[model samples]
Target: MSADSTHAVEKDDAVFHLPGHPLPALVTLDSTDGSGVDLFMLSLRRPVLLNLFSMPVRDGRVDLPSVAQHECAQQLRSVNAELDALKQQMPELAVLGLSLHAPECLRRVREDLQLRFELLSDQQRAWTDKLELPLQSQDDGSQALRRCTMLLVEGQVSRLDFPLRQPSEVGRRAIELLRRETGTM
Candidate 1:
């Protein structure tokens, strides 16, 4: 490999656990618009808030999301609602939602919940595999992506929160970072 490529690899390794790691540029995630886009490329122009969550399993065993999951989703929606007010101040700020379900599945939830942000379906789990985010253990022992949030600035992950304890706090944190970075506040 060339020296630049070697240095890039070393840098990626160094920030594998850090906050400023560069994300994959070509993750072909399906958006609500039906066309697919590369996540890193989409976030390159500005800051992107990535909210990783999962839908409630509708198998024969359970029909509704657990209390914790429901609360998280509610908080995420709240964050999406708050983003509308910030758009005037930060035009380049964007919010993207991700789930492990297929596009159709996410579409139903998005429409039903009237979500303001776009949702990306990771049906193949390719993105999760690349990031190595853990799957949360269910009461029945199945695994799914727990609530996680990431802030990307210029294609680099500026902050990452996993096993998110307070969803509303995430919105505040992201807004604070954006304000500080953009000097708007």
Candidate 2:
């Protein structure tokens, strides 16, 4: 239930092994679709990828639901915007937003960050929970998810990123990897 464990102290040590692990069967979130879509189902069609981004700041620090403020939520929005460009660059991979919180809470994060990608709620996060991505919780209990990306080549583990140093450059990197894998680049 808690994503605290996902974020580990040694980011490089983050875990990502899904080849043997069947993808979770939870419902996908579709904020962009504006009608709530199932991301997991979509990924099943092809290769559904994921990247969890931690927020620099949070208002849930002190029951902010009663009193919270918009803070440094632009980071994810920026990344999501880049996803579009990245989409063009990859042209084949479907992007997914694997947030620490379920869609309900992630909804705010998405809105605050102004993200465009399809964000799915890994509630149990059966797949990401043990991955040790990155996390930090406020005294109030609201925690931040770490930053990482998981690539699925035909619904298989193509690559998994743990606390990636430069998610912004992920597009270029994905392009290069795709090129190598598909012999296009």
Provide the overall lDDT of each model, using Cα atoms, as 2-decimal numbers.
0.65, 0.51
In model 2, the runs with Cα more than 4 Å from the true position are: 1-11, 16-21, 25-41, 56-75, 130-144, 167-177
- Model 1 alpha-carbon drift over 4 Å, by segment: 1-18, 60-69, 183-185
Clashes of 2: 5
Give the RMSD in angstroms, all C-alphas superposed, for model 1: 6.4
Give the worst 10-residue stretch by lDDT in candidate 2.
1-10
Q: Which residue pairs show backbone clashes in model 2?
A: 6-133, 7-134, 7-135, 28-38, 28-39
TM-score for predicted model 2 compared with the true structure: 0.61
Model 2, range 34-136, lDDT digits (tens) per residue? 4554544555576655666543334542232422232224334445656765666567667766655545566666565566766666555455554444566
The clash number for model 1 is 0
The candidate scoring highest on lDDT is 1
